[model samples]
Target chain A: MNVLIVLAHPERKSFNGGLVDVAVKQLEDAGHQVEVGDLYAEQFDPVEHAEQYPHSAVASDYFYPLNEQRAHYQQDTLPQDVQRELARLEWADLVIFQFPLWWHAQPAILKGWFDRVLVYGGRYTSRMRYDHGYFRGKRAMLSVTAGSPGIAFQPFGRAGDMVAWLWPMHASLYYVGFDVLPPQVSYGVQGGGIEYQKEDALRIHLNACKECWATRLAHWEREKPIPFAGWEDWNSEGVLCETSPWRWRLG
Target chain B: MNVLIVLAHPERKSFNGGLVDVAVKQLEDAGHQVEVGDLYAEQFDPVEHAEQYPHSAVASDYFYPLNEQRAHYQQDTLPQDVQRELARLEWADLVIFQFPLWWHAQPAILKGWFDRVLVYGGRYTSRMRYDHGYFRGKRAMLSVTAGSPGIAFQPFGRAGDMVAWLWPMHASLYYVGFDVLPPQVSYGVQGGGIEYQKEDALRIHLNACKECWATRLAHWEREKPIPFAGWEDWNSEGVLCETSPWRWRLG
Candidate 1:
């Protein structure tokens, strides 16, 4: 199997980066081809604007992101970095996002990855998203680190539910047709109550997380993807049907 | 009242910009002082890195974001843009985030604003978050535009719950002690089912949304802020207490 690990962190020696190294070694040892995309190392330009499109397809006066994206994609004139990411996605059977959760979500750099790399007309159209997404058969998962403890992120915890905070990302992955797996969250990565426990305690926790991640990857295929309501489960108005299991949560 | 509308859109002529214009006019007419922070126009760098902290108090080899933030803030040496934003926050009683929803959240530029501007030690400490956050008395709301129609973002709509998508952002604002109001979502800004209604229909819709927003702004002071669990509501481990009113949703 081919795998792509996208790392979004400023410091290469950070715990988030350490997890990427662990993933690479683990996946490679399992006889899989692995490539890591270190976003910070690449100096990825995150802001999407008129500047991203040097070859103008839209009017000089206006910049509609979707229109420009569609045009560039159709012309095969996308930016080099975007082209490289798309190529990686095309080659990978599974993709892993490695990052520290910031402000209850992925950092801005990773957020921009979804904005730029996923071309509209080429990657997803009105009919091409959800179960029919361009990368449907592929899989994606988030490996996140947080500053707060696991208890703080429990359901109704002070730090908020990890699942709820990650729902946008999970939903986006599902929208684009990846079989989304449940996230592997390494909580209390630094500071918070863990600091009172002692500084080296974080070091110990990091190693333990690395071991847990490796074990999970080896037996990953046995796990089922997290469930999501698909097209068939919704009515013409795009809402869940009466028989849909998702109703209980929404209600 | 002082209001700051931070806009994160590429095109100034876009509908998102139009909403900001409508807001400025409405709030100003109501005798409130208002300021607009055009992130794109300012060319705000979204990627936070070691370079952002020019005066490094940490060792040259390693860069920890929170540590650097705390050090720089202690020295009163935060990035100019961040300092400016912090000043704006200090002056404002209410803040409005105006942007089109990209991939179910704020655009990368706006997301970066939170990452960069919310200083670790100064803006929030482990003890100074959630209900006890620094900006507790201030109010914040998201004025968002979407490509999909309202029906598609219903409880279990295909576009997914708008509430779920914006949860991370809402939670972030709440963390920093802002009373997060329910978002003003102007759905179907373009494409999707709206385009079938003809391109000019989007124009009509934009105008109507502007009117609606202006009308709402007139009575905004009366609207109660969205409720979130406070510090008192949580136990020592940070989990919500059994008697808490928030338990119903968690269960």
Candidate 2:
């Protein structure tokens, strides 16, 4: 098995980095080849614009990211960084996104990964999305840390539902044909100032979080992907069919 | 009304740019003071790391972004760019985020805006968030454009729910006590290569979308904010009460 851990945290010494380290060790010990995409360390350009398309631009005047993505991808003239990331994705059987939740989502760098790496006409199209996506057999999961406690992320909590916050990411992964696994959330990650808790307690918590991540990765292959209603569940107008169980639950 | 439109698109001549222009003209025509934060034009550095805090470092060994943000904010030594943005936010009565939805959310530049500008301790703290955030009285709204059509973003649509995509952003704004208005999404925005539609038809569609946006801004003051559950709605554990209406609806 091949595992790609995309680490999006700034500081490599941060807890998020620690999680990636844990994953690499655990996955390697399990006889898997591990490749880590340390976004910050590589200085991954997060902004997707015309500048990325130095060659093979479909329209020179107006920059549509999707068109540029498709053109460059076909021409094999995509930016070196993007080509490298795509190569990594192509090599990986499973991908893990390790990052601290900033403003209830992944950091800009990781967000731009999806924007740039996931080429529209290549990775997905109108008909080639959802279950029929390009990377159908691959699996992906998010390993996120939040500054707020677990309780605050519960439904109707002050921090809002973690499930809801992760839905967009989960959906995107699913759209690209990856079997999306449930997220591993390290809640109440005392980020900068450890004023709230004792040093010993914080250390214990951090270690425990790392252990939990390691344990999860040990059995990742056996875990079931989160259920998402696919094309068959929806009607012609792209809404959930009246008879669909999701309509009753989600509507 | 003092309105700050933070434009996040790369190309200044793109549709997203036109939307900003339309917004400024409309808001100004309605006797509102408008400020456009063209992130790309200004070359705003979106990456927040140790480099952002050159002098104000609580701990030089580890880079904790929140701690640096709080420390720099208190010392009045925040990076010049951050300081300028904070000043704009402070001056604005209503904040408008203008961007193209790249990967089910705002562009990386805009995402970084939320990460950098919204100071952790200064803009929001555990106690001073939600209804009591630092920018309590200010109103913030998202004016987004999507390449997909409206039908594709319905509740069970192929594009996924627009509401879910915007939830993280909406919750983030609401967390900082901004009254988040319903997003103005111009769907089916035929981006760079408009081979599917004729030039005249594309022009008409673009103009209509601009007019719709302009019309909405004309009544900005009278617009009611989208309702979100408040602190009072949750229990000590931060979960919604069993008897709460949300529990019945969401659960």
Candidate 3:
């Protein structure tokens, strides 16, 4: 198996980084080929703009990202960084997004990866999404860290539902035809406070979390993807069919 | 009312840009003081990193964004751009986020705005969030454009549920104590391609969408905020209390 771990943290020594290290070692030990897309280390530009396409623009006057994406991709002129990321995606059987949950979502850099790297016409088209998505057969999962503890992320928790925060990302992965696994959330990640860093208990807790991640990766292939309503579940109007069981849960 | 419209689209001539114009005109005509945070025009650096906090560092070795945010905020040494954004929020009674929904969420630039501008310790804290957030009195709403039609965003739709796509963002606003209104989603936004840009029907449709947005802004204050589970509805574990009415729907 081939694995791609995309890390989106600024500090290489952060807990998120630690988790990536653990996953790489664990997956490699399991006899898998692993590649790391260290976004911050590579200085991956998160913002998509006109500058990304100096040549091969379908319309030079107006800068529409989706159009530019489609045009550049068709012309085989996508930016080097985007092309590299795509190539990584093509090489991997499983993709893991490692990042801190900043502001109830993935960090801007990773969010931008979805924005820039996933070219509309080339990667997914109107008819080629959902169950029929481009990267079918691949598996993807999110390994997230949060400043808030586990108790605070339950349904109606002050930290808000972790499931709810992750839904968009999870759904996005599913949209592109990957079997999306449930997220591995490492809660109570102490950030920037000296006491938490110095405390032995916190250190022990973090180590345990790392071990949990390594253990999860060891059995990733056996995991079931999170269930989502696919094309067959919907009617012509694009709403859930009245007879669909998913309607009861998600309606 | 003081209104701040933060736009995240790259092109000022695009349909998203047209919506911003409509909003400014509508709000200003209603005798409201309006300010536009044109992120593209301003060239807002969406990526938050060590460079953003050169002067103020609680711990320089490992960069924890929230810690740096809180420390810089406390010391009154926040980056000038961030301070300016904060001031805008402080001054506004109503905030409108205008953008094209890229990757089933806000564009990375706007996502970064949420990541960087909303200071953790200063704008919100562990205790001072949800119903008791720092921006409790202010109302914030999203004005979004999508390439897919409205029907395509329904539950089980090919484009996925708009509600699910917007939930993370809506929850984030509610987390910060903003009275989040239902988003103004202008769907079927034709992008790039000379045909759609030149089509008379597309022009007519865009005008109608613009009018709809303007009309909504005219009665903005009269509109009720979308209901959310509040602190009172939750138990000690932060889960919705079993006895709470919200438990039936959201549990």
Model 2, span A40-149: residue lDDT tens: 99999988878788764787767778788878778888899988999999999999999999998999888888888898778888889889888899999999999778
TM-score of chain A of 3: 0.97
Task: Tell me the TM-score of model 3.
Answer: 0.95
DockQ of 3: 0.65
Docking class of 3: medium
lDDT of each: 0.87, 0.86, 0.87
Q: What residue pairs are clashing in model 1?
A: none
Residue B112 of model 1, lDDT score:
91
Model 3 residue A16 lDDT score: 88
Q: Which stretches of candidate 1 lie over 4 Å from their true place?
A: A191-198, B191-198
DockQ of each: 0.65, 0.66, 0.65
List TM-scores for all candidates, in order. 0.96, 0.95, 0.95
Q: Which ten residues in a row have the lowest lDDT in candidate 1 chain A?
A: A190-199
DockQ for candidate 2: 0.66
The CAPRI-style docking tier of model 1 reads medium
lDDT of 1 by residue, A1-251 (tens): 99999999998888888888888998999999999999999999888989999877966667788889999999999989999999999999999999999999989999999988988998999899899898998999999999889998888788888888888889889888999988899987873222233568676786798899999999776678999888888888888899988888742
lDDT comparing candidate 3 with the true structure: 0.87
Candidate 2: true contacts recovered, fraction: 0.70
